[model samples]
Target chain A: MPKQAPVPDELSKPFWDACNERRLVVQNCTACNRMQYPPEQTCSECGSEHNLEWREVSGRGKVNGYCVMHDSRIRLLQADQPFNIVVIELEEDPAIKFLSHLPGTPVDQVPVGASVLVDFQEVGPGQLIHEWRVVG
Target chain B: MAPTGWFPTTRNRSQEGLGVWEHRGKVAVVGIGNSPTARRWDETADTSVGAWAISAAQKALDEAGISRDEVDGVVTCPQGMGSPWAPNPIPEDFAKAYEPTDNPDDGLTGVSADWIVKNMGLKNVKATYHTPACISPALCAGAQVVGDGEASTVLVIRGTGNFSGRYGQYGAAAGDTASGPGQWTNPWGWQLIPQIAYGFDQYCRKYGSSHDRMAPFVLNQRKNGALFPEGYYYQHRPDDLKISVEEYLSARWICKPMNIYDCDMPIHTAGAFLLTTAERAVNMKQKPVYVLNHVSQRAKVRSSVETLDETEAFTDSIARKVYEGSGLTASELDICNPYDGFTLFTQYFLEGLQWHGVQRGEAHDFYAGDISVKGPHPFSSSGGNNGNGRTRWWNQLDCIQQLRGTAGERQVTLKAETALAGAFTPNMSDWMVYGTSPD
Candidate 1:
């Protein structure tokens, strides 16, 4: 297997910087004013060669959907556990979408379209990254 | 809500096959099939979901027709549960689970193969695509259609490895972020929370409760699911599904109005089906299940999920559309599958059919044994995703088995019947109904 390739260059640099700081950032194109993941160099909404800036979000959102993914590689890479995949419909000027796991909560107990706020979980030194979690 | 007819006999009956058959005017899902359930090691990482799905496509094709090249276009969706929790969330009852060595990919490979066949522009070629978590792969197989974008022949099949505790799932981040799988999954950021719990959290909040209350609902779901071998909670019960407010802190925050139990389970697998237009089916091998009527539509607003104005999250527009298209009322069916992953969904599904004047209340009046192909109405006798099995493993497999009359211990004695199956979600909802025989 090709060594699980690193997050490509076009999508790198900034992504690394945010994770090291425990801040969650999404790349929004100024030209198209659309948010993208996998760090698109070209705007997906409009064919514009736009530059992306790491803008922070309120991290407040609702659970549009969810599931107990009985299988995964990412979490297994860290801990041998079955993590939940929570699909977040963000609440921003133009809401963004995200998928991630929760911290310290039993996802099965959660419901659809629930309100939540952002939180962080430390994984490593300067390696702390933002993870979604249910807020009270 | 009285049944229009106790039983009607369809004039179409073909006795070409060797196996014992029944003709009761109602259409029965006479055929059931699958692709080989791949072990973790049998397939490769690059093995496309289409590859896994096509295996079963061939089997369903063999059942539908002898020619392998008669298929058409393809349609399918990934219907397995959407993981919405921690980096790695195990089955509620992980202690009693078996793990697979490998996992399967998502999408309609089964339908893709059908496209390979149908796009050949074969006459009588048609395609359909469907998936509701466990039965996703199977739905892919059913969507085969040829030229003109519409063929008389269509096939639907889905397969699932079913979650057997073989693998764990994690969503590092569906957002544009710098988080690695590990760093992304860590509870370091809130922006990346899975949306599942948020749905429930929102629901509870709006209802003036906490997400913790959803446990009883799920526990009950597990209780009902115990009857099926393929159920994710085969060994779990309501008592074990406990979660406190503090203990339930998992996701960063996804969606609202629903929660974890409110969501579906993500598993591996495939299923397939061979569908022929009623006209073409009449000329084919044996008496095929006829599509007397169907109504499929998606609510842009998820009328079902609305807080209260609607009787249910599911609305009646589509079910009514089906009734009008089929020129039949809910009083016309002998069986039903309400796309039940949870009771709430099922309740709304029932209401949708009821809007078409289906006396769902009366259907439950008959005894389980009395409610058969020969008796009143049998709803999900092979067990629904919630009743017998779920998407992770047995959703498609069980539906096929029941419709085909191949369900081992839970088989109902019905010669003629019409069955309904559906998949409902916030984004899209699909509803389909087929008659085993046209009386």
Candidate 2:
């Protein structure tokens, strides 16, 4: 079986679309001037509906924390066992976070608080998911 | 003084004092019951999820010495079959495909109050509620029902059923696409373990704690769980379930910072508690464990998983609420049974409550000390979910038992006048305090 890919709904489509184009975007609340992620219909800060605007970001972040999975419950990812799932706090908004396997980083060696940059991976046809890479 | 306008301002009787919980000592838990914990749903004729719920309810009623006809209220946290993360099957589709029998108790994965009422033949049930969380909140709701006179005797139950498959396996998708939050998490193989492990890792790094300091807690839970007759290990393989410090330290990692022992064993089980007004409870068969106060808080997290700081904030808020509501201090607690569904939660609760002067980041050091039932600060002697199977109610059950002097071999050596219990994570959780007297 192929690895699971993001099947974006209407609200998340733009965010995923930006990823496909090798860009990272976050939802900027026009009303509150606050940033959000994973797409919401309303501004979380101001609760203003239809006031969310997509804004492209530098895609830079820092490793907040991480865990190395020695086992895989997902069958397709079993072959790629012993991977790291790193929590990335986006440079755009520390509150807006993302999970990444941190592909190139060595297992059990995630440097917490180290800087990282977003990288996209095509797991399925036209499905570009965002991952992170350690920045020197 | 009377108000001049239509809005009278004579402090509503219940809200007389700001932040004062009027429901303190208004309700009491008289009895607790548990079905035999099992690794899987034993395919026995009388061992369905609904059946287990009914059995637990019956035991509670019996233990309370309250007749079935006296049960006037029911509250349940229903459990569905299959992976908990799987999308719930449409009710109509599920009923048509799976629920064939008209008997409410038969062929049930999730057990509801209506089914329990029908199965137990509870004729006087006037109030029914479903708390989508776990048994802690169900008990809280039950207490409210009794305290508010919605019912004189209320039974709160939580039942879990496991199907034949890997626990928490992702539901088979229609295609290779992951929708919803799974789109972000599942794609990277991020499941519950990694999510929690991340929190533990952050906690260790921030606090200078290490996994080695956690062995005492793990071993303590196993020791107590081995003695708990209703637990899965004790019921199934009592002889082989014991663990040593070396064994826990050497245990293989499911995820770094979270070995297999750090996680609670999921099992098919159901637990029920009988609650009533403190007035009525004083005359019941068992000694009344007064419901002093409870706080249910939902933390605001910016991300899918709560950060360590967020968890600490959540814990601190809960601790303050619990103390303010009950008018009790952490020093006054005789025993504590914090949720250990994930062992790390226990550390969070200890540090959060500062129980017995355990300061921030000092829980690991506290754990390194004596945490046995006979220790100054007794913790989770009932084996919790870590020692017991994941019944999710053992903490509360043990609290009630400890307060009532009925915990048998696992009872604390101290004069157990007061106890505390909680469920789920430090963030978004339910916590309650129980005492031997209403005061």
Q: Score the docking of each candidate (DockQ).
A: 0.07, 0.58
lDDT of 2 by residue, B1-439 (tens): 1111111112111121336456778899887888876777655536666667778888988888989998988888765534552333334433443333333333355567766776677788888876655787777677766777878899988888775677665564323667887786777777767877888888888888888889989888888888677788888877545888888899889888889889887788788899998888888888888988766766667665678888888888778877877788988888788889889767888887888899889988888888888676677878888888787788898888888887878888888998888887775677778888888
Q: Find the candidate with the highest DockQ and give its number.
A: 2
* Overall lDDT per candidate, in order of appearance: 0.43, 0.77
**lDDT: worst 10-residue window of model 1 chain A:** A1-10
Give the native contact fraction of candidate 1: 0.06
Error of 1 at A91 (Å): 15
DockQ of 2: 0.58
For candidate 2 chain B, which ten residues in a row score worst on lDDT?
Answer: B1-10
Best candidate (score: lDDT): 2
lDDT tens digits, residue span B1-439, model 1: 1111111112111111212112122222333444433222123422323444555566666666545455543444433343322233323322122221112123322223233233223344334344333343233223212112354344454434333342333334322233343322333222212222334333444445554443433343343355444443443332333434343345222233333444444434455556555445566655566544433343332111222223233345545654554445677654556665543344445555772233333222222123322234444443445433334324334445555555555555653255556554422444445555554
| iRMSD per prediction, in order | 10.1, 2.2
List clashing residue pairs in candidate 2.
Answer: none
Instruction: Indicate the docking level reached by candidate 1.
Output: incorrect
Could you list the CA RMSD of all candidates, in the order they appear? Answer: 13.1, 5.9
Please give the lDDT score at residue B277 for candidate 1. 50
